[model samples]
Target: MRLYNRDWTRREIEERVGRIDQIGGIQRVRGAEGVEDGVELVRIRTGAGLSFDVIPSRGLDIGMSEFGGVPVGWLAPGGVAHPAYYDAQGEEWLRTAAGGLLMTCGLMNVGNPSEDGGISYGLHGRVHHLPARHVGVEGSWDGDEYEMAVKGTVDETSIFGDHLRLTREIRSRLGENVIRIRDKVENVGYTRAAHMLLYHFNFGFPLMDEHTKIDFPEATLSPREADMQVDGYDSWQSPEKGYDERVYYHRNIRSEDRASVRIRNDRFPAPSGAALPISVELSWDAATLPNLIQWKMPGQGTHVLGLEPANCVVEGRAAERERGTLVFLEPGESRHYELELKVNPGVTAP
Candidate 1:
């Protein structure tokens, strides 16, 4: 297995993005087309008996998100919007500029068409859709399932390359609910692009109800002190709400690997008719990647929770380092990041 890198030598990954034609002749329901969004979706059943709803959010060129469901969490749009929902306006700066205020951006629709409204900010990270050229696939397939790899790149002009190189490949195997997301990022320029932040990964779906429960081990969490609730509509905002009006910032975080965190998702509350979902895990075994974020926002209007696994924590990469949690890479240096979504279904009538 040759470890791929982030550099000009990388191939175009976009060529590989397409529908999965299963050998078993499994049928999938094509998602309704959104006239303006130009989003394409394919439901693929991996050899492992697990399935996934894969959508190529056409416009945002180079990027994609995978989970058992679509659009995972709250991504403030890129340009502008309600103050509570997004940080819309921002400026570019690394060592000098203040943290970019991310607001609503070119929002993508996922989940049921009629009610699709969640947003992913950092505009899904500028890399999400960077006019990818597309590379070829590597990896083999067994009788049950197979693996395919794709690559893409983009160039940003500056005195220094201040440009970025990114790579993400997915592994779909049999008998596993987990799909592995492998990524690499290289700062190909001179000045450090610190003062950075990545919030684009957000997951929401069957778990977007008040009955949903979010659980994690947090013995050393320091809550973001706020006397008032940020959201007024959420019935979940009352003081009785366990996690309302506050963001738990955890230190002394424990994980199977420091590169990533273990598990984060909204589980169905008991007394519901909905089926139980398997566990989803995002692990970062590489450098560059740090902090595993689990954000549950049951504010009045919107209902969803986000399990964000970022290369750097909130306030961006520099902020994490300022607080003594993130690592820095030199020019041309890179880090390998991987995420595993273990979808273990519970026993049911066959």
Candidate 2:
């Protein structure tokens, strides 16, 4: 039975393979006792229960996500940190912010930390602690369905400066709970490259407490603090212990061309109740992510909620190049980003 060198005759080494039923697959974990201990995860089990954790070093974000067993995201207790402890400056990347489910902030810069011509950006960029080259994992069997993915390529170079390149792809199926992300940000170098991206998506504790609810489409919630107080942007709060985090900026109302957002938790009773309520959807493409940030942290163990999808406007990178809305990338040009994360269990809410 020759496998790697090719030739295998004897009726092809007594061929009789037949055991294809895999509903899901892709496992290549390491350290931290099962998935985080110096980080290097890739555990994606779809089978139907839906699982996640693909931190190819780091830039391949997405740290935690589960379905039937609960906990749809949010991890940051400093859980998955290895990227050699990344810390470009200012807030120290929230001390290895692993508040995941998907956190791929930017390619060059995104949100708060200013300084431009003199260079000083920090606080959301660095492409989530960059690292991810090659890193692959693909599974197939489409006739009966059972697709799986996880590809990578992050590269935000800098010698003379800025050379960008990020080709990520994370898909899933096989009793799908859904999670498809495809990015491609090239500008392989020569000039023109400002590009900023965001896709934070974080939620915790039974999909966030206090009867979570947030379904926006006809937006315009702005309130990044101008004496902030939007009166419960979408309502949710219960983890108090010194809470103080609120940043909203949705501006949707596109009316068409794909753009959805939801985060319901009717009462959170899935498993035993046999799929009760529990929702989560964030489809995208309003002409390539048109900005929507809303990170309201309730506090306590830092309960999370940060469904951000952006292309710019977290106000850094010189205030997005003085509000011209900074988003360059042309020197070979390349930009494409599609995201979808649905996990509806017995859905509700028309």
Candidate 3:
């Protein structure tokens, strides 16, 4: 296995460490306090300077993530609150959004709040706030390669309403600064159900600042609001007070099978006292996730850059239905989505 920039045999590495976990492994923990009480957390550590937390109690979504002791994921002020605090009404979902590394946005709806078929739908969706069952976590070696993974199933179903089940698996290697998320959404009920999915990948400072640059394949960019159409769509700035959030939809992404968006910062101070060019790339299956949403909000106390990939836009389910863009899943039907997030510790600034 490769660790700390060198190849080593199991015997040699084991001799130097008291326990394998001291180098890299998985540990299960529980949040104990106020909003985070009783939250189950699966902490993963890769010897290659990558670490993250996976919350099974919160739809098996990823929370804090770091590379080389530097935060690669943006954290909301309230932190990872317990799912019990989730409010599924109108805009109240933001209270417990917990803006983490990855937030799974849907099953029945994704976007604004609205009324559909005499039923009121909330802001994003209930998927992120749903608890997972049959959660599993493991770390094993596969012929010189150490692999760590966590799996869970989250169901969004009522008595006779939508019965959608999302089976998610998040995996990483011992010597890699990468995380791969695989999800399968299935309509397990007898009737057809509406489906909308989005993966919200948020990035914040000091990884995102004025020196950061975003790169992606050529695509048609459409601002969510007409007045939001301005310059600097590929650059960033420091946190500004009272700055309004701007969202843009990228359509017709030019990629063969998958599309990737990269954010790079040229002047990130490393733990080694060096200014390293840090880069993080998010890639997804373009065929399944056909659209990308760029959420630029460099506002004070809310500074974040959201690189979201989804099947539907954030304009809400009703608007999607009206535009003939809503997706539906029939009984026993399933859809698969794949995503990878990789961190490059050192890169030549372009």
Candidate 4:
């Protein structure tokens, strides 16, 4: 495995494709590859459980990245669950999770680009697609495969926009085939305003196909997106019927011992066709991330899944008010949300 550092400019670039200067928040520290294993899963501590290795290989594509011999898909990049377009618009972008993991909290770009979302600010946000400022080198390890881990943070007024203080410790391990997220959010703001925090996990399609299903904790879901708008790719719908804007509200689904859900593509070659499950285990506070969004984009090409745990359901403040999902932090208050993604790989059920 290879080790290095990720600064602030690189921290938020985790959303979508890399735009180091356009990103904010956390950044990456370690990167490596695996010889025996095709996909050298690294141990990255991202609250998003998703990130990109952003390999600037010696002789590879400036956009492509991989430390050793690991599968590009694993370290490639993941996407959020929603289409940037909501109201006949395009995809939107918020502040990303950083560490070159590639993230944007909101839609891709529907009406206008994030730089001009018509909201005075930019489309995604000031730190929507920015990059992180290299802080320091983290660590590297080697075994059957390679594992990489790093650390970065978001200063006040980045993504949170609340003059919030963000600290992230990202770790990626090789061979283990799984990454863990141990994170914390501190509200260093003066006024107590409503906040929305969600992880926009992007998984490659084919890897996400007709066989995929999204599971949740069964809490009273906020509500469906009124604008059953369209996005990229097609979908491998479930056996159920009346599949228009399908959503699930759960309570115990987030329990560590809960059933797993996934977004698998029958055309893809992962575990089986629509067989691999993407499950969520609750930690921190299950009630906060009560609502889970399941989206399917099949034929659009580059299929992916977004398992979002939002503080607010759909309308942010409106959903939070209805679902009572809003979490408040005093002038010096802080809250932490922990989520872990265990790749069943070939295991249909976990």
In terms of TM-score, the best-performing candidate is: 3
Which stretches of candidate 3 lie above 4 Å from their native place? Answer: 348-350
lDDT by residue (224-252, candidate 4, tens digit) is 54455433222444233433433333333
Q: Which stretches of candidate 2 lie over 4 Å from their true place?
A: 1-23, 26-48, 51-66, 69-103, 111-135, 138-149, 155-161, 165-199, 202-223, 230-266, 271-313, 320-350
TM-scores across all candidates?
Answer: 0.57, 0.34, 0.98, 0.54
lDDT of 2: 0.79
lDDT of 1 at 205: 41
Per model, how many backbone clashes are there? 42, 2, 0, 100
The worst-scoring run of ten residues by lDDT in candidate 2 lies at: 1-10
User: Lowest-lDDT window of 10 residues in candidate 1?
Assistant: 96-105
* lDDT score at residue 60, model 2, on the 0-100 scale: 89
Estimate every model's Cα lDDT from 0 to 1: 0.36, 0.79, 0.90, 0.36
Q: Among these predicted structures, which one has the highest lDDT? A: 3
If the candidates were sorted by their TM-score against the true structure, best first, what order would they fall in? 3, 1, 4, 2
The global Cα lDDT (0 to 1) of model 3 is 0.90
**Candidate 2's error at 298, in angstroms?**
14
TM-score of 4: 0.54
What's the residue-level lDDT of 209 in candidate 4? 41
User: For model 2, how does the per-residue alpha-carbon lDDT over 1-350 read when each residue is reduced to its tens digit?
Assistant: 22223533334322433332333477778767522566788888775676888888888888888886677888988778777777888768888777778888878788787678888878888888887988888776555455778898999887988898999999887566788889899999998888888888888887788888888776677888799887887868788988788898887547567788898887886777653676788888877787788888888888888888887768788887887888898898998989888887768585
Could you tell which candidate, 1 or 4, scores higher by TM-score?
1
* By lDDT: ranked, best first: 3, 2, 1, 4
